[model samples]
Every structure is written in structure tokens, then in C-alpha cells.
Target chain A: MKGAVERVLRPEEIPQACDDLMKAGARLQMTYAWFPEPGQSVEVAYLAVTAPHEPFLFLRCSLPADSPHLQSLAPQIPLLGWYEREIQELCGVIFDGHPEPRPLVLHEGAHPSMPPLDPRYQPDEMMPFTSEPWDRPPVEGDDVQTLPFGPVRADVLESAQIFFYYIGEAILHCHPRLFFKHRGMEKRFEGTSPSLGVVLAERISGVDSIAHSLAYCQAIEAACGCEIPERARYLRTVLAELERLYNHLHYFGHLCHTTTLKVGEAQGKLLAEQSKQINGMLTGNRFLRGILKPGGLRRDLDLSTLPEMLNRLQPEITTYLRSMEETNSHLDRLITTGHLPLQTAYDQGATGPVKRASGIGRDLRGDHPYAAYDRLTMNIPVRTEGDAHARVQIRMEEIHESLSLIARAAKDIPEGPVSSEISYVSGGEGLGWCEGARGSTYYCVHLDDAGLLARVKIKSPSFSNWRVFPLTVHDTNMMDYAINEASFGLTMAGCDR
Target chain B: MPVWTLYGIRRGIATTSWPKKDGAVAQPEVLGLPRYHADRCRDNCRACADVCLPGALSFESCQTGERLALDYGKCIGCQLCTEACPNDALTKSNDWAFGVRNRDDLIWAEALKSPPAEEVTRKIQKYFGRSLHIRHVDAGSCNGCESELQALNNPYYNLHRLGIFFTPSPRFADLLLVTGPVTYAMQGPLRETYNAMPEPRWVMAMGTCAVSGGASGGGYSCGHGVEEFLPVDIYVPGCPPNPAAMIHALLLLLNRASQHVQGGQVAH
Candidate 1:
């Protein structure tokens, strides 16, 4: 509430408020439920944001502890569908008149009566695991067939099942059931010191470690009203860009692998490994974990050698990207594959490169300007094709921009203390956000009376994009499914968590 | 295609002769598992244990009053313990090659000592004949393990050069490599994959989560590690063990390399 403009409204006013916010050119950032007081009342918070550099608008409504019910906003705001379903299952809140209000995170094996997130529920009271038959949607046609892909897919990949209904190489509908990797990450942050909360945040999505921890630290810092050193801010920018470079490179390689470009895949992956080596050299960790804390950084890092290393790797990466762009065989498969219309992308709440590729130029780095991004200047690339090729192009251009940002930060960074003492304040709440490699990641922190974390709600970029992914696969051919998926670079761990 | 060939050739041979030669180049300026010196530890000090979020280091009441129990399998290599220690008991090192054949080999106890030195003979080579196929399963990892696992096939590592391939089917796999904390939803699928594999198959836990549930273990949704539901033959314990460490672990399983860490101490 301290960092956000807080307002209290009744359950019935939620729909009209969301409509008004959308009319004012604001979008739904996140919607989550938490127990303000353990067993007394259930509070639902909705966060909305307007264009560039606007503070978040927080809307709250209370429900009775005995029977928590709310008018479903998913009918109007399509983005709230999954969030409301998750809240209904995990927090035991009922959304009246909701369409398709089935189980989201918990399958049938979980305890039927007890909500795990409810403060009154006990962990030992969980029911035993029992196999349940999956119910498939009835579709009638001559060539219609349902194919269940995986909880365990081929190659080294995360676990999530995908249901594809198709006819002779053409897909009719696609349904992805994720959260098989949900380790209850947000629940794991409860009752822990905000310092330890950063550690848990880093593990939320391993590839987005710096972005997740940075957002978590900024939340704690904002709650305490502490300003970190200038040097730490610049170093944080460098680390975040390094993460972006490796991730985009990996995305490029995986895209190549999907397109059957063997040479291109090897070249792209080699460049990614080199970028990781640079991360290890500068931060002492390949994934750039454990360097960030609540206040600032745990220790000062020596980054004098970063610019030189980046300078050496830039040309190889450039040539590799150029070669991939020139290859017609690779470009042919991606040009018109998995086309997502502009209106559908915006309506489904797409973010990051996916949204940008569909001609929505919304980037939190240029808009919100967190972690020293305000000081650095870079162009946000946008493509109007709304296809796999456009998405790949956005990432390629982003890799070039990330390299320049890292080099500039390394050169202009000042020498000073990297951290400050964090004095935790009770009953303080703050929201922090960062534009990670994938998209914008938001972390909202609420400290309890003992100054420990009561609730930490993480709205990952993948959660939005994963919801938008199936929209593109509705009528696409099965041959291009893997390529379309590779271009999106969606991580199940990030979305499931 | 010709230009691509030229580009790759210009870069030259980037692969490292790791298992045959010293492979320090693979992990430069990187911090590995913290080395715990038993003699340097002070009595009744909980400095390291208090900050360990994953319970990798804890003070247990032993027969001799109190002792620090160190388990590399549970360590995430975050360097928090090394910074929290008042004494010089825990220090940072560059020994990234930590792959063991036994789960207990990763734990440090006063009564524990290094087992007999193993011969570097290729014991399992004849059984598998030409090459080894691996079927990787993600129990509930953070995706860091999969990231590093993908790098094994890169030009620098070129995992295929070592006669190991990641097959798409478990039926053709000789070893099952697992990552993550074995979340509840994945428990059944992981078992199904293992059951589908051929006989004489070995399992390798590739990360701290798969070894002893690094950060998100024991939560309401996930268990501690794969050992709870599956038998593991090797434990390579880093937050997400680096690409080179995974190669060492695979070779150690094949008896091509000796165990590097015993009872949480680097043998070298």
C-alpha cells in the first residue's frame, strides 16, 4: 500500500473498476489473494498500471472468512481467468459465474476439503495420491484426434503435458497443462526473513535469476525506504543484461534446433556458453545467483574485465546472427508459422518480445525504468508480422542491444560500497518490477508484524505469455508446432511457479 | 552451408580434453562447493547453519556433544556459509568437479573417512558395449539443471565425443539423469519413465534439488529429492551442477574417472 495507490471497493465494483482502468489505457498487471489476518478475512488485491512511468494502482476487496465469494472479472478481463482460477483453488475462494472454473494448480490428488494456502489448513492432513482419469473435450470430426504430448517430453526439457487436437498435420486446438513443476515457490517464501526471501526468489525461475532477485530486493528496499549505492545499481544493470544475452542466445540455438539447422544450432549454443563464461568470470557464478540481497549486493564485484571479454565475443555473435538471418531454409519455416493477430495478443495479455513482435511497443525497461535503465538509452524493437519470424527477429536485435548496454554500464560504473543495511519495517508493503529476459516480472512484498515476509506474490512474464501461446497454435500445422514454441521461449518452471 | 562450415572452422577446435586432460579452463573464476575444515571449526558456533536456507550445513548433537554436519548434496553453492563463518572452517575453492558414486560420499561426518581408492579401469564399458544413452527427467527443477545439461552438447563440451547421447526414449537409455526436487505431480511420471527404461539402468541425481532438495524441497507440493522415490547411483551436487561437472559424473558412473569428492572433501 505504501508504494501503490490503495483503494478499497466492494466485490461488485470490481468489474466496473477494471473496465474504467482499461478505458483509461491501463492494463491488468496482476491479481492475487492473501490472508491479511490468518483466519479472519480474505483480501483480494488487483494491480493495474497506466503507460510509461506511472505508479501501480492497487484495488482491494474483502470477503468473509466463512464463505469467500466474488463476482468473476474473467468474463471482461480475459487475463484474470487463470489468476481467479488459481485463487479459487489455492485460497478456497469461489468466483461466481466463472466460465470453466476447474482445478488450475492442484490436480485431483490434493486434499479436497482443505486449501493448502489457507492458514487453518494443516500439511499433515493431506490426502494420499490417487490416479485420476483425464477428461478430454469432446470434438467430433472425420480426422479429429487428440494427442497428449508429455509430462516428460523429449530432450532436456521441463515437465508439462500438452494436448493437441489435430487433423492430418493441421491442429484444431491446443491445451497445455503446466504446473507439474510447481514446488509451491511463493508459499516457500512465507515466514522467512526477507534476506532469505531473495534466495528463494532466485530459484523461482533459474534462467531469470537476476531479474527475480532484483525485483525481490527492490520490493524489500522499497518497503524499508532504503536507497542502495549508485555503483550497485550500475552493476545490477550489467548483470541483468548478461542474463538477457545468454538467454536470447540460448533461445536462438533452441530455435535453430527446432528448425533443423544443425550448424546454426551449434554456433548459437557456443556463443551462449561463452556469455555464461563471462558471467562466471565477472560475478563468480555462471547463472549470476547469490550476488544480490535485500538491500543491494552481498559483496562488491570486480567488473573491470567485463568490457574486454564482451568486446571479444561480440563479433562472433554478430556473424552467427547474421548467418541465421540469411539462411532461407531456416527463414521459410518461421515466416508465416503460428500467426498471432494483434488484437488477440493484446486481448490475451501478451508481454515481452511476444507482445512487441505483434506491434505492442510496451517494454518495462523503457517505460518503468528500473535498475538504472533510466540512465541508459536503447531502442525497443517492434515487428508487426506477428509470426515466429518476427519473434526471432526481436530476440536477435535484443541480443545486440544487451551487448551495448552491458559494455556501457561496465565502462561508466563507479567504485563505491555495493550494499547498505536494510531495516525491516512491520506492516510495510511494496511492489517492485523488472523487465527480465522474457518480459516484465513483478514482485509484491507484504511484511508481517515480526518484520518477516507474510506473502510474496510473483507475477512472472511467462505466466502471461504461456496463456497467450495456445492462441497462436489453434489452427497451425503440427510440423511447425515445435518451431512456434521454440520462438516463444516459454519456460514451464517460470509459468508453473 | 559452406559459409557455416567456414565459420566453425575459423573458430577452431574449442572442445576441451577434460576427462583425459586437466580441465580447469572449463570453470574459471567460478566458485564451487565450500570446503569445510573440521579442525578450524569452533565449538557451538551456528553461524553457518543459521544462514543455510537448504539445511546443507547444520549443527547436530553427536556422541561428542556437538558437531557440524556438512552435506554437499544439499548445498546450492551460494557462498553464504563461507561468508557467515567467523572461523576459517569454511572457505571458497575452485574445485568444481564434484561427482560421486554414493549419496553418503557427499556428507561430512567425523567418523566418516575416504573409502578405498577406485581403479580408473572402464568397468561398465563392456556391458554397455559402444556408447551410453541417457534419458533425462525433470522432476521439478528450476530449469538451471536443464540449461547446463543443454550446454553439454555444445561445441566446448561436445558430450557426444565422450560416447554419451541423450535419447528421446527411455527404452533405449542406459542411465536416467534427474533434476529438481521431485514435485508431487512429477513423482508418478518420473517413476513411469524409470520403469520404462531397460534393465541394468543407473540413475544420476544431477542437482542439489534432485540430490537433497536444494531450496524448494519438503514444501507441500514437492519432496526432498529423487532418492525418496527412486534409487540414485551418482550424486553431482551443485545448485545446478555445471556442464563439466556433469561430464565428470557421467564418466565416474562408467568407471572412466575416479570419485573426486569423498565425505564432502575434495580428494585432489
Candidate 2:
């Protein structure tokens, strides 16, 4: 991959080019279909980031609107199965010769006339209109007992149905039915001002709000060639890392909760609650919604509050993590269970702690250097075990790095305005990539002459990581399933959106 | 392993004193509801209404002049309207909690209106007077609401202290506290969960999404709020209502407490 490259290729060259790029140590970052107008040829773009921090290489190919078909790239990168099914269901882009063509985001309730995201969908058409039943994928074995987990269960954060095919206790196969929370996110971005669209993007996955909106704004800024001020960059860095802090805290709290360690769970939850309160003080919303806009930040940060918030965070976090490390009950439950092989992780494009625990040292913050991450220096922690314990270790390590990053960025914060002037002529496509708390988040924004989005495509970190679940969860003990699931810290809403 | 217990003892008590004391200060900076002043709103200026993303703020021109209407159910509390208002008509105030017993009490015209002058539902009060079991369903959410819901079980809120426990099985639930706008795929499961609950049950719509569909209300993949499919007895509005606010709503379900925030105004 070379510096900032974009080119259109014939349909036949897509798979071949993707295969070559994969061989060259490039990982598929995002894939989507773009329809500029109804009845026009469907344009598809495949974005890949090469190893050792190479520039992004964007490869595009147009399929005729009549056929709307392309050769599948799953044969090259097996994890693209989710991406392919998503585009097939939303954009009506048929993946010819693909292995699994079952519906991904769409269900029986969607109007049969057109895919929800199809350019031809009428504005007046109701979203989907029924309590649609999902077809549970067959998980075959002789003594397999089908266990449907949930679209709604216990105290799980979001809704998703996972079918575990089990013979007594050991699992034979796992088939997940997601999109129970799909809300027509991408299609709704049409015709809205980019400033308001920032709000929409933030809601793409509420936990990853800052990362998503920042990426969306970065896309618009990159398109307009607007350079954010140094102060803004540093502030963005602080906010991003702060977000990473809260999410990691939340994930750890959850991990302890899964172990049924009551005291440890409270300790973790206390830390998580403090993070939310801190976020509320810093950004006015607990989840940091509406703080990021297209040109830059929605407003300036109150510099005086930073030292106090950071001071409050450091000691509490350190104390809890220190106690957690020394606690055997907590550590024992996490060790040597829910192991995912490094090869499976890499093959599936697993990200965040999942990828780091498996020892694949690829972090978009360090690699692509979005926001002001390029200004900060830190080590990307990695663990070879790829077990539940390894995931915890990675998150704990990242929390320390994030705290250091925020402190350094805040102290050395440049003296300038927070937001910059941006001029939008509209009629270009730009890609925004950021390392969210969970993992990498990708946004592709295409704007028309009217400054409204022609199309908005997202490949959330959850979308890529969910594919790895079936591959890893298979053959794991039935009783250990909940703990293993907690290990990944998967956000069903992100995947469903 | 035994040392862990010593460590826990060293950590000591961290429980918040909300409902017991004035310790319910969960998110101090979050202004619970957006306070609206119809008079301060400049005549014929629809600036606040125009920029409202979720259509929570709206104005209609009439013979008298222009009338501004606020449906708290539709408000995600992003505060864009507060920023958009040229005058001090809409100001950012700390009024985050807006959990009410009757759904209509959420709507605002000009003044803060109280719930019906009539008496309470004696039957529900009698059934869940002391304790409440809630079964939460995420019809279709961004997980912002769910994150807050999870926090309710944390040390700060410790919801069980308030006699509300989140039961996994709907069979034991007295109230169905549902979040998210009902999505296409989730409709069947949400209804099934509600139906599974025995008689003398109530449904509380938490957050703007479940109350008025939030941003994804009429989109291609979502049904507008839970009210369309099920009977919602309470409506709590926020992008994701904070944990303290969630407790207020749950308490209001059994007539335990009166409405703290009415219309867009929060009580002192």
C-alpha cells in the first residue's frame, strides 16, 4: 500500500487485488456498497490498512445496477462474510458464489419491495412492519440439542439471539442471530446536514459515540481539507483516551460480575460509575453525546476542570486494578479459559483487546494515528495467551497507557482555538477511521452537492469481531460460555447497527 | 485468596446514600430536562425547533401568533435547542430526572402541568407497594440506555435497596421496564416477555427511544416506541436516562413518589 491511493478496478480484479493485499500484510478495514442514485451502477469500495503503519489503499469497483453482483472476497479474507452479507442485505449487492447468503440485518418485517438501505427505497415507506421471525441457522450434530439464548435475556446490555448446538455439555457449533436492534441507521443519514449527522453518527453505537462522531467529522474535515487546531487535536486525544478509560473500566467490571465475585464486581462498578460522572463533568453528557461536530468539537473544553478530573480518576483506578491483580478468585476464573487461537483471531480480523491478547500488535491509534494520537507515545500491549485472563491484562494495560496519554496531552496542550474554519462544497467521499474503546471504528461518508449525505456506510468494530465468536466459542464448555462471552466484551448494538 | 477478603475490608463501604440521604447526585452536570420559556422565545423565531434533531422541539404558526410545543417523550435532551435559542428562552438547567406516572404529563405547552386531578391506581399500589421486580427488555437501543441500566445494579444505585430487583425470568416480574424503540426483529420477543409476566403487571418506557422512538422512531428498521405495541404506564425521557432518574421512574410506578419534573421544568 502506498500513500493515499484510490482507484477503480474491474469486477474480476477485486478478489484478486484483495488477495494480493492480504498477502502483503494488509488487513481489510472496511467494505461497503455505494449507490449515488437509483438505477445507477452500484459502486463498491474495499479499504485496507497495511502492516507497519502504511497509508490507506482504497480499491473501488462498480457493479451494474441490473445485476448488482460481485465475486465474494471471503475466499481471500474469510471474515468478510459478515461484511458481504451486510452489503447484500442493505444495498441489494449480491455476492455471487458466496458460501453463506442468509440475511444479516434484514428480517421478515422489512418491506419486500426493496432492501432498507437501497437507494430506491421511497421516503414514505414504513421501516419494517412486522414482528419478523428469524430463521435459526442449522448447527448440526447427531445428539445436538438446540439452545436459543436470547434477543432478550437476564441483564445483558443489548439484544441478540445465539443458537448453541450442544451434545450434553460440549458445543458442536454456534450460530448467532443478530440485528434484533437494527434501526435503519445508515439509511437515516440521508439528506441531513452534516452537523446534525454528527449526532446520528454518535448514536451508531452509543458506547463508541465519541469515536464514531469524531470519525464522521474527521471524514467531513478530511474531505474539506480542514486542519484542526493543535489545541483541538490534543483535546480530541484526551477525550478519546478518556473514553477508552471508561469503557475498559466498564468491561473489567463486567468481567468480574461474570465471575460472580460480589465485592470485586462492586469495586469495578464503582470505578465504572466514576468514569461516567467524570465524562458528564467533562462533556455534559454521561456518554459524551453531542460534544463532537463536523468541523471540530462542538465547543471548547474547560481547561481548569481537567487536572481535578484526572486526579480523581488515577488513584481510584490504580487501587482497583492493583486489588484485582492480587485477588485469586478474580484472576483464577479468568485464566486459561475461553481461549481463542492467534491464527483464528488474525484470520477473523479481531480487534481491540481481543486482537492484542492474541498477540497481533495492530492498533489503529498507533498505526493510522487518528485525532492527536500521533503526538502521543505509548507501547501497544500484547499477550500471547489469548484467554480470558489475557483480555483482562490487555485492557488493564491500555487503561494505564490511556491515563498517561491524557495527562501528557492535557499538560502540553497547545494554546489556540478548539475548532477551525471549514468550507464544504460537498460532492466527495472521505473515509474516517478511529481506534474506539472497543476496537477500530470505520465510517465512509459521501456528500452530494446539497451538503446532505448521499450515503453513509459504517463498519463498526463489533461487526468485524462478531464473526470471530462462532470460530472461538465452538467446543468451549457450556458452563464457561457466559464467562467466555464476557471476555470479548462484545456490544450487540454496535454489530446490529 | 483469603487476603482478597482483607483487601475488601480495607476498601470498606462505598454505597451511595440516594433516597436515604441527598446522595442521589449521580450526574451533577446533566440538566435533567430542558426548561422552556414560551415568552422568552423570540416571536416568529423557530430557531430552536428547526435544529431539533429528534423533532422534540416544534412550533406552529397560528392566528394568535406562533405556538411552540414540547413533547418530552420525543426529547433526547441533546441540548441543541438550548444552544440554538437566540434569547434565553431555552436555557441549560440541571433537571435530568423526568420519570412520570402518566404519559401525558410528559407533554409541555407553556406551563408545567401536573398529572390528572384523579386518585391513584389502588390495585397496582397494593400489589407492588413495598417491593418491585423489574424485567428489562431492550426492544432496539443503542445500548446507551442499557449501560445506564447495568449501572443501576452497581454500588451507587444498588437498586435492590429500593426494593426493585431485575429478575432474569419474566414470571417473577411485576413491572416490564423496556428500553429502546421497538425494532422489527425484537417486537416478537418483547411481547413474549411481557406476556410471560403474570397479572398485575405494569410497563415503564425508559429513555426517549422507548417513549417516543428517539432518533430512529420511524426509520426503515424500527417501530415507533414501545407504546405502539404494549401499554406503557410510565415514560422516562433522556438520550439515556441516568441511573438516579431510572430509580425515580421505578418508584413513581407504585405511587411511591410524586413527579419531580413536569413538562420541561424540574422541581426545586
Backbone clashes for every candidate come to: 0, 4
Estimated TM-score per prediction? 0.97, 0.96
Pairs in clash, predicted candidate 2:
A127-B220, B32-B95, B32-B96, B33-B95
Encode model 2's per-residue lDDT on A76-141: one tens digit a residue.
688787788888987888888887767777875566467667667864367545655666665565
Task: List, residue by residue over B22-119, the lDDT tens digit for candidate 2.
Answer: 75567677655578776787777888888888898887777888788888889887788888889978888777668876677777746556455424
| Regions of candidate 1 where Cα sits further than 4 Å from its true position | A122-127, B111-123
What CAPRI-style quality would you assign to candidate 1? Answer: medium
Error of 2 at A361 (Å): 0.3
**By TM-score, how accurate is candidate 2?**
0.96
- Write model 1 residue lDDT over A1-497, tens digit each, in one string: 66678899998898898899999988887899998987789999999887787788999999888899998888888888889988998888899989766777877666546666775555423334666765545677887899999988999999999998999899999988888888788888888889888888999899999989998999888888989989999989999999999999999999999998888899889889999998888878899998999878898888878888888998888888999989888999999888888988887889899999999998988988877788899999999999999999999999999989988888888889999888999988988888999998999899999999988899999999999999999988999999999999999889988
Deviation in angstroms for B155 in model 2? 0.9
Tell me the docking grade of candidate 2.
Answer: medium
Question: lDDT scores for all predictions?
Answer: 0.87, 0.81
True contacts kept of each: 0.75, 0.71
